[model samples]
Target: MHERLSFFVKRDSALHHLNPLTKIVLALSIILVSIFSPWYWTSHGLLLVVIVPLVFIGKVANEYFTSALRLILPAAGFIFFMQAFFQPIGQTVIFNFWFLDITQESLLFAFRIATRITVMISAFTLFLLTTHPSELMSDLTRRGLPPQFAYVIISTLQILPQMQAKAQTIIAAQRSRGLDTESTFFKRIGSVVPLVSPLVFGSLVEVEERAIAIEARGFTSKKAKTSLYEISDRSSDKFIRWGLVILVIISIVLKLWLS
Candidate 1:
């Protein structure tokens, strides 16, 4: 069997064995609490106290940190710099340059937003690193999620990597054919059309092929299909999910009360 394309790393750990829905709830709870909490440092606290430790508990610390440094930090850092300079939320200027000034309030606001984004991405990264996408879909499908909805979720998760791989292949082929992709800025911009045309067309053809293949496998059939692997949703999983729900409620209440 061909291995599935996903962020999942195979390992034995408490976090890995938790029900996929429980992990989903856990990630969402972290994100919601960080976003809705009244305290300015809530996101930073969650990142340090909860998400970081969970990375170790899941036994994927090295992989998680690699992904954070490679992908998550750059995205969050960009947002931080943009919001710090352009948010225009406060008047107490702390630093000034020709046309750009950093106010104390803006800095604080940007820090909160950046940290919230970091917590959000890190929690989801942890979830994906631990939970297999197929397993997640199977659990959701067994729990009464519509087959089409589950398939959409699975597709969304897997598409980006597929597209990225496809783009690289296309770029390599173009370079082999004497395409000028790296010489100058305008040449790079001009090369984008050639790269994009094939990528878009190829992706469309792939979608059609996948649709035909799934249809042949009875994707539209109403009969219950069996999963090759069983997903466990133990009592502990339910308890954890409920606890996350409670935490989310508390955060929302606190935000409202403080407001």
Candidate 2:
């Protein structure tokens, strides 16, 4: 399970073959477009058209949808309640209750916001599920991010598994001590706090040790750093990067012309 979580899905799909940098840039572009474009269904529909196919191609549709739903549902609920209560009164009210009014415009706006968030969430989830965390760190470092920043990103990824293992160990040790995790909500919460306190302290110490180790290994003084794995830049990568740049330019031009 640890091995599965750490590695990328080894598929022979075109997206899997693209350089991680290209994928990151594309994902960011889509996210930016989704956020800045008009909060309308058309803009969100276009984003979905692009992302849904990719999710299917990557064979992570279920995971992507699950992650997206977890974010979208709460967001949708909040938008619904807020708009239903706080939206400005308009000439065309859809519903009137005692002292509240829900206008058609507000309903549309709420729908637009919820759809936009869904598109953004789905776009990011697809990107994260497809790209390996290590590859993302390497790409960032190659793109001139400080080695320290890359180390921080990589360390964060490494820490998740370590923390999980440590938590399991602590839970077992506590169980041996007759601590009950299946007690009332407050009791379970209280019991786990002390059990996990050492893990939190240990993580801080580990981080300090890592920082010292990195500095001692000449990470800061080195003029150049090399990666163990190199992401090959092929003709296809160049073509795709250029294509995306052209697409962004076209989108901007269209937006201006239409406006």
Candidate 3:
């Protein structure tokens, strides 16, 4: 779960050379475009033509493929399947599973939904893969994003993996003491309390210490903050950001017109 959340793959590539903010704009633009596209197949086409190519351009194709297989596919697949069975718009029935019927209209709708979801996730996955968390925060801070927001974002990213590790440790300890996570559904439901309680309380215990640590480091200092690592924005990065802004505008216009 955390692996999917913090899926940064460091590589020296064209995508990595772009400013963090540029990548963010690009990601947001793609997400908006996919969601508001006039054509049914627009999102699917973007996923295949834009996102797949971006994985190679970023030189993190291997990691992107891994994430798509492990995380993206499963999530999008479930939603697609659910919508196909339950959506109420279809006239032509494709199949029937007891009370649930899959219809042609529902299948098309689900296809669009799944494709949009893929485009959204793939765009952000590429952005995170190329840009470091600190670099992203520093760039945003330079552009008037609150310093506290930066601290919060970076701190959350840093702590998530540790929290995941702690959860795994607790699960392992419980499993050793005869907790069966793979048993029946009711058993798994019953097991949630034991698994979550420890992780929740343990994380809570660290909150005070984390607050103190941030305060000691002058987290709220009014002086202009400095970045240890410099990320230079080139003319090309500016051009790309402007292009993405235009694309976002176009997407919104199309959405309104369609509605």
Candidate 4:
């Protein structure tokens, strides 16, 4: 269950070894192009031609697939379904149920939007799977990102797993104490107070503990701090980042001209 919340997968592969900034740029590039490109099939092509192959190349195919099935697909599916039913765009209605109707044009539009969302999510997933959060934060800090901002980003990435773990622990403890979480709907809703109270308080305690811990480590010191690990930015990483930038520029130009 904790692994489900943790996105980074340790693997020995070229994709995993790439500079974290390069991976960030790569993910952003895919997302920008997918959203901005005028071509209807751009997202589909990116998923098949780029994202899928990168998963295997990163040696994180299993983890990526699991994340996609559990999280990404459900989200995109919800968006697709909502847009298909609720979007009042187009006249050729193919299916109608009371106030909800699915038109041919609306269906196509929903598919395009959902596919673009999938592509964006998949790109970020791939990056997270290959690049550890610490490495990414450290690299960004070295590249002129303020440490305060870097700490915030890393904390955001890590806090979800911590909160999930805490929630599970609280739920288990409550279950052992005869809490009725498995009862009817209202009973379950009532049981949530017992579960959430501890989780929220525990999280607040943790935040206080972390603040003290960081302060003790001279987190606010003006002196330059050294990293335990030296992050590399090789020529290849630079080349890839530049190429991605050029592609993004081209995508913007194409969208402008075509639109």
Q: lDDT (0-100) at residue 35 of candidate 2?
A: 57
Local distance difference test values of all predictions, in order: 0.91, 0.74, 0.87, 0.91
Model 1 TM-score relative to the real fold: 0.87
Q: How would the candidate models be sorted by TM-score, starting from the highest?
A: 1, 4, 3, 2
* Candidate 4 weakest lDDT stretch, 10 residues: 1-10
Put down candidate 1 lDDT per residue, 184-241, tens digits, no spaces: 9999999999999999988888888899999998999999989899888899889999
- TM-scores for every predicted model: 0.87, 0.78, 0.85, 0.87
Q: Which is superior by lDDT, 2 or 4?
A: 4
Runs in model 3 lying further than 4 Å from the true structure: 1-5, 168-198
Clashing residue pairs in all predictions, respectively, total 0, 0, 0, 0
Better of 1 and 3 by lDDT: 1
Q: What's model 4's lDDT at 143?
A: 87
Write down the TM-score for model 3.
Answer: 0.85
Candidate 2 lDDT at 54 equals 88
Specify the poorest-scoring 10-residue window by lDDT in model 2: 1-10
lDDT of 4: 0.91
Worst 10 residues of 1 by lDDT: 1-10
Stretches > 4 Å off in candidate 2: 1-7, 69-86, 89-91, 95-101, 178-193, 215-218, 221-223, 242-259
Which ranges in model 4 have alpha carbons more than 4 Å from their true place?
Answer: 1-5, 156-165, 168-179, 205-209
